[model samples]
Target: MTDYGNIDVEQFFTGDPIEDWLDLKRREDISTGTVDSLVQKLQTNSDGTAFQQFLSNRDVGVLDATVMDLYDYRDFIREVNSKREMKNKLSEVSTFYNDMRRLKQTDSNPAAFVLSRTDTRVKLPNREYHTVEAMGDFLAFIPHPQMQTMCLCYLKYGLRRGAVVNIDLCCVNIDDPRYRPILMNAISNFIGRYAAVRIPYIFTETSAQMMWLMVRNVATETSATTMSYFRSTTR
Candidate 1:
């Protein structure tokens, strides 16, 4: 039996290089999700014929396929796919050849030699920003104090919704005397443990006070059992 790292090539090489490579991947304990994705990519093509069928039609096994064969396949991929998709398809092909080389099934990776003419870097669309007046009007329409505070936090800190939601009460320190009673109540009921050192918070003094006031009102009004500063009453 041919020893290729941990895999026994003699037992697994069943004439189909793609099937052998996939089986090797499974033997290596690759994640099921990852293996399933690879299988889907190999079997599905826009033109009804899969990559293995394309190789078979060219009268070449994967291990014996030439660089020119890969270039032709790349062209086929480009015909119906986006530049990004073509890049991904070629990358998967290259990965398969790389594994073949590792298993000593092939001496060279022909897919690695294939090159593309298209610029594959996907450009993100430009985002439009609201004017100051527009932002004020939008904030004015949000009726809940908690939601209004959350929106203000987004505008002031440029924080994502998830980040705002995950902000624990212990993360902020509001020293305003007017809000001290509410802050004390929150601290007493706060279930989350404080870190050894103060966590670096992004909120300014005014914004922190606003958030505390909103939290205080929310805690008093709602039956939310969650200890998170941003309490949701809905199940």
Candidate 2:
């Protein structure tokens, strides 16, 4: 956060704190997809977003909001939505407050304190793992060669769909006696420094052959053509 003593309240305050904070987000270099999603959430939700509804109900300025106000919003989300949904809503509100605090718009972050109170454990559904026989069936089911190769990458290396599409041909060196055949380069954790994330392709010869064939095809394909096909097919 910026120096508390240096923060000029008169300069920062614009009579409407929520409008000013939202305008800050608009001018920020945040992802367009993220902004769109946040906007859609506020627009689509009948009760409005956690903070939006809170401000509407209380008719209080953003700077004047208290920790109790945040708890009230959290309770409101829990009543109308699942715990997981409440968690997400709280996170968004916390992020907004933290951003404002960092910019010297506010001294305290009420949502940050409320986050601990709203934490809940969400249960996940059981998943079935694919056996060798099941794998063969899955491979056979996918008729498209490139798509099958992509699936093989997922099955053998546990590569995410996004990572599979972004795998660079230059990083794949089959001749190198490395444990992993393919490397997902410069995968940023966002929380830490960038690092290379390797996905092992140490499966059967059939899978390796399919992967190598796809690699060869990718190597020969033009960038524009590959991107066009990737965009069209993925969508």
Winning candidate number (lDDT): 1
- Compared with the true structure, the alpha-carbon lDDT of candidate 2 equals 0.54
Candidate 1 lDDT over residue span 38-156, tens digit each: 99877665334576678987777878988998899999878857877878989988897877677665755444433343344644322234455655555564455785677666565
Best by TM-score: 1
lDDT tens digits by residue: candidate 2, 32-134: 7877767776556556555866787789767788898889888877787787787898998888787777767575555565565674554332223335665
Query: What value does the lDDT take at residue 140 in candidate 2?
Result: 72
Collision count of model 2: 0
TM-score of 2: 0.19
Clashing pairs in 2: none
